[model samples]
Target chain A: MEQTSILETRHLTREFKGFVAVDDVNLKIRRGTIHALIGPNGAGKSTFFNLLTSFLKPTRGEIFYNGQNITNMPPAKVAHLGMIRSFQISAVFPHLSVLENVRVALQQRLGTSFHFWRSTRSLDKLNDEAMHLLEEVGLEHFSRVLTVELPYGRKRALEIATTLAMNPQLMLLDEPTQGMGHEDVARVTELIRKVSENRTILMVEHNLSVVSNLSDTITVLQRGTILAEGDYATVSANPAVLEAYMGSSAHD
Target chain B: MSINRILFWFTLAVLALTAPFMVYPVFLMKALCFALFAAAFNLLLGYAGLLSFGHAAFLGTAAYLTGYTVKDWGLTPELGILLGTVAAGALGFVFGALAIRRQGIYFAMITLALSQMIFFLAVQMPFTGGEDGLQAVPRGYLFGFIDLNDNLSMYYFVLTIFVLGVGLIYRTVHSPFGQVLTAIKENEPRAISLGYQVDRYKLLAFVLSAALAGLAGATKTLVLQLASLSDVHWHMSGEVVLMTLLGGMGTQAGPLVGAVLVVGLQNYLADLGSWVTIITGGIFVTCVLLFRRGIVGELRALWKRSF
Candidate 1:
């Protein structure tokens, strides 16, 4: 298959108060595939994700999203370019109903958000699209329920639903299944797999089993640098990968 | 569309319209004016989570403009009111931009400092008549022929303006823009991530609130035929805050109920002199400590449970 890179970083680096949080990292995410970035605590995976999504401006280097340099663009503008990100913790309007939450994102895409006088009900197509997105995320039944009232796992799902409302070409999921029960983790992992069919998905996963089970390619990071990158079978068996996971073992 | 909520608001509006017949028209008019003031304040405090301490600038500025124009310039009441409202909105645009640069307590402090500066300016300005204010300002014809010198006619006119202002606020809150304001209040960062220009929304809300407060203050000046230092003082700002807090911080009807109660207390206790201040202060403390949800908020909460 021809390699079509959806997102690429050229020697990306970020420094905070004299300490390098993300150091000289190079990454390439192929179009239409699930790529997982896995590492131990303090390995800077989250910082790397932040840099990619333009939440934090990179100290050095360039980010090319679909061949456009978006090094220091604001997150909202970056999101408008078919890239959307979901937080490790659920980020949503708790006071808004599930449907309203999705509708806001849908509104952003439709360019009808600033029409203050027209009743929001007039945007029937947008509402239907929002409901469809909710349905896809299995939240259609809880459409009118306030987001704060939703179950923890369901809220996480709703976050994805909201993100999906933007119709992003590339979806960034930071620990998409974190802090979930075994059942929820499985359900979310399955959902992520289903979502990955059309859009390229780059996610940070702590659970090796989930990564091995879902990721087509895995990149291992340790101390702000990529330790190993390949298919799960090859990287998981690499001595460096094993040492990075175990610590000081591969050094000996 | 809920029957109870609809009936409740309908009944309240009817009572507000009719209360002047039973109670002193002047006192009812005062309450109506303050109700508009409190509602405007609540637009910022309740929806945007911005606690302004200089709202009196808008009120007093409008009052003075309305008073000076009607008294000295010989403008009609409606034209004078328009001039006042426009001035308030213009002031809000400038002050809101400056105040919104800082958030939380800093924003409140900035507004307070600006308003205090305006108050001192008003005290020295010759047009405001210093401490004496611009008294004996003609009420002028409401449209052209309807005389406003009659106390009952004046009360109804004030009530009509108050109702219009409140209705405007209600429409604003139910609008989609209002939802975005709530979203910003709940979590500004999240709203930004979702592509909202939060600061712009906040500034607009501030301007709208200021204009409405000006409308109230201008109406009050017409009612009393004076625009004095009391309208622009820091105490007036604090009073609005108290009204909003006493009624319910974010609830719509809270400010109205809070304003009416405060206004009525002041009218009944005017003969008690300095005790009015102490009593109002005591009520403020009690409301903050015990009845923090205010009358309408408490009622809504109760109604929600029953349903």
Candidate 2:
């Protein structure tokens, strides 16, 4: 109910047949902050993200965005409400030029996505804006290259650029750096930090170092429920949180 | 468009303009109609990545409607074609709305089932003339002025429509709308997460393609002077698919070339009887095994590599 909270979930629960993937849980993401959700494998991080974006229906509970109930809003309509998301894997239009990839996102704002009779040349108006997004992602040089030709790290960066094209207020990034070298990880980490300004980011990151570096708040989940919630120092030092990560019998 | 591409189209146009002098106009008109049908099918398959196995419904429905209107109602050729095209579009909207929820082979099967339903209806419908078909469909005057009675004048009329249909396809492919369709084809989920109403885009593309296919069917009814059950048969749907795939599913000129080649073989090899189907099947299999992108696609790849 806090005014600063841009997104809030109450008792959100999702079950796959008999298995509960995302248990009854309450969470809040403050405006203009980077919040990271971390857990062990199969901890329901993805399911929770899917539920938040309404890509998956919650068995029980409600989601509120900016004080409006958006529990069952369609994914595209949610996106139109400025809550954009990136995939766990790099998702780009492989055959389109990198510039065209950004342009597709920008084109939605033109209210002419259905105008089959209009020439694509009219899209030239968005070229400068699209290039600026590319430049922000450090991909201006590769704008003309087919997206499939980009290196793995660059593709993730392009995904970010496309997401940014929406000028979203809230961004849900599912493993933005899931598979990358140290160099790519650092570059994407920095890019995320740069783009996170004046926006709210909810990320599911596996890398502890990246989590410790970027997250303003960290929530740890175990068995589809939050085990601990605090700053890195506080949560990392929690005995139960350590038990979840390092195992219960580590000291015994 | 590139200068080379423009020149290529120009060359083709010149050839088409002068071809009737050396070849039969009726045969050429037949090829042009099939080419238009194949091109419309390609718009869904190649660009939108939807494979509808029931496209003949649109073609057949339009053909029959145009035939009835022109023959019995004495409507002008243009009005009959327009009515047919619009009816086909409505039918497409229904089919697309139902089928788009499924994908890949299932989508194709849904279309095939719908087309078969139309085919049986055609067999029983009174106005369709049953097995004998609605024959003696007069070409009628163009716009109540220029006579389409003469074969040459009729050929010109058909040619103009073919160019406009193909030009519209070209424009649709290169338009902003086309970009979204391509995006949906490449990655449907990604297109949705990026805020596109993916289903709506797919439906619109389907309807536009169906209308164009219907236009071809309606025009053919006038040219052939008959609206037959064969036009709406499942075989007709399959033929358009084969033409598109053999021509090059996504290429601009692939369907046109494929239609001409197939129609030419069927005409010239008429004495061979059922062997024409066998030969066409053999070529299709060969094309799939060797150059899967079809003749035009393979040639373009070769030109790219050599240059």
Candidate 3:
């Protein structure tokens, strides 16, 4: 156990009716680094992300955060501990304006999300901060538009902006660039690089280039377990990792 | 707000104020009460994405409670209405506690089942007076000073309560809490990831909505002086859904528009017995086919204003 490891999963396993999605795998996400969980389609990357966020409970495992056990804690409780997960699909409130989308998350930080009697106008002070988040993601110009109207690439950018509103210490981005043009992919890659400066990031990305460029450390999963864990230069050259990507069973 | 926005509400107020002079004031009072009921239902359906098929439970339960308090307990109109609203809220808490655990059509079914139980209880409960109802319940004096026994006074009193309920709903819709509820509706998992307790927010919306619906029901008791099975019946619950759907589920003015139209149609076509339900069903189907957003929602789409 490294002293800098902030998030640790011990024997994390998730089974869906006897079909094991995530096997007994230990994951330790170090502090202040961009970590990528890369795997083939159906390698249980999504399942692992869900388990870490407590969106899916582990069938047999324990999860810990900063030395505290968070195995059975709910998603909201996990998020309150400063971990946030983005969806593979661009997830933003469609009816709410982009500015309002970010503002909704920002309002949670102020502990005023429950004040039904108070006017949302009273929270106007949060607008500046929200706008700044949009600006960081190059979405300030589209802040007044409804989120549903945003282009696919811009929607991904908006999702990142909303996630940033939580001021999360650990950010879990699930395929942040799942569907985007080359231009959008680069733009978002740059945006992720900028936001990763102060926080720990756990991303499940399919794009090899995205994994190679953004990730400080990469854990290659094949058939629900880690095949190779190291920096890109080390993992990319590993025969087992090459075998997994080459469509051969790494276990064989 | 734009001039169209101002004109919209201003016109509505003027029509509401002057309608009693031209049409039957009693009919107007009935429309207003139903309008409030539909609006409350819309709070859960349109904004929170909750569909409770048993909303009549709150409305009917509150009617009986208000009727009991004013008629039997000799409470003032204000006290009766307050008690009814609170009782409905308490009922909402209990119902929401049970119902919020489920989602989508299942949630609706649970609520429907629960309301059916309430309906049966109303039919069997002696204090509710079963089919005979608590007839000739007094409107009593508002604050024991403004005698509501007069028809005109009662009309104005009911109108005031309607406006206040709508106004409170409007404020809630525009508030931070409303924003959170919308977020929850759009994506529950994402909302939870942002550290918001999604269930708690849903429950709050449910209770607020139930309490407002109860407020409408309580007022209706004063208007009609009767608490009966018709109020709590499953059909009444369906009727409110029809009103909201025809009006525009998410838009502010949709429920009121739907309520007024439904109420007006029933009043004018009272001579035609079963045709009213057929007409309502036809209207609902037409709205779903052409204007899925409802009348007000489509209008808002055209006008580019927040309804």
Please name the candidate that would achieve the greatest TM-score relative to the true structure: 2
Which digits, one per residue and each the tens of the lDDT, describe model 3 over residues A1-252?
Answer: 556998999999999998999999998999999999998888999999999998888999999898789999989988888888999888899989999999988897677778888898977899999999999999999989988999999998898899898888899999998878899999999999999998999999888898888999999998899989999999989998887787643321
Greater-DockQ candidate between 2 and 3: 2
Error of 3 at A8 (Å): 0.7
TM-score of 1: 0.92
DockQ of each: 0.43, 0.85, 0.83
Model 1: how far is A97 from its true place, Å? 1.5
lDDT: worst 10-residue window of model 2 chain B: B188-197
Local accuracy of candidate 3 as per-residue lDDT tens digits, B141-215: 898899998878888899999989988899888899989999999988989999898999999999999999999
Clashes of each: 0, 0, 0
Ranking by lDDT: 2, 3, 1
| Model 2 ranges with Cα > 4 A deviation | A247-252, B1-7
Docking class of 3: high
Those runs of model 3 whose alpha carbons end farther than 4 Å from true positions after fitting are A248-252, B1-8, B304-307
Fnat, one value per model: 0.29, 0.82, 0.83
TM-score, each model?
A: 0.92, 0.97, 0.96
Q: What C-alpha lDDT, on a 0 to 100 scale, does residue B26 get in candidate 1? A: 81
- lDDT tens readout by residue for model 2, B1-307: 5999999989988998998898999999999999999999999999999999999999999999999999999999999999999999999999999999999999999999999999999998788999999999999999999899899999999999999999999999999999999999998878988999899999999999999999999999999999999999988999998999898999999999999999999999999999999999999899989998899999999999999
- Of all native A–B interface contacts, model 3 reproduces a fraction of 0.83
